[model samples]
Target: MYTLILVLGICAAALFLAGFARGLRNAVIEYRRGKPEPTEVPDYNYVGMAAISVVISATVIALVGVAPMWIYAGPLMVLGTAAGIGVAFFVERPSA
Candidate 1:
């Protein structure tokens, strides 16, 4: 069970990296085509991102079980909450 969770976590991380790469490629292509500079970060669909993150964390915690929960849950929740807020701030902030 733990091994499965680890593998899933790795897969999730890989997918996230691939997505970031794809977004970077798209932005580069747009820039190369002389498109008007994007005035914003683009709509990130935070609901989708949040859902995935929650699922990943939940899966991890379920696999890790209760003993480590005390150690992991607090930090994960705090950091995840902070990251969510940070993303929102960036998304909402006007582009300079």
Candidate 2:
């Protein structure tokens, strides 16, 4: 039961973070599109941010003693990031 809950929680968090990163990236792209000089707006690196989120999230869970680091961290970081990014890519951005 505990393992199931933990897995679900981590999956949910990963999905949310990935979606947020995508949304933020889209917003930045749109913002830059509207600008006369796109170079003026700084670029957003979603991949780096997503990777950081995955690592930090796993670290926090391990530090909190919720589960052993080996149990979920490594596999979830890879799986979660892949799955999350995949899902985010499929989701359609809102019509501007």
Against the reference, the lDDT scores of all candidates come to: 0.58, 0.67
Candidate 2 lDDT trough over 10 residues, lowest sum: 35-44
lDDT per residue for candidate 1 within 1-96, as digits (tens), equals 456545655655555556555556666666677746565556666998899989977877776675765555544455445444444443442322
Task: Specify the poorest-scoring 10-residue window by lDDT in model 1.
Answer: 87-96
Model 1, residue 87: what's the lDDT? 48
Residue lDDT tens for model 2, 1-96: 458657766776777777777778877887877845423545777998899988887776676576565565555555666666757754854436
Task: Give the runs in model 1 whose Cα sits over 4 Å from its true position.
Answer: 1-5, 38-68, 74-96
Give the distance in Å from residue 13's predicted Cα in candidate 2 to where it truly belongs.
0.7
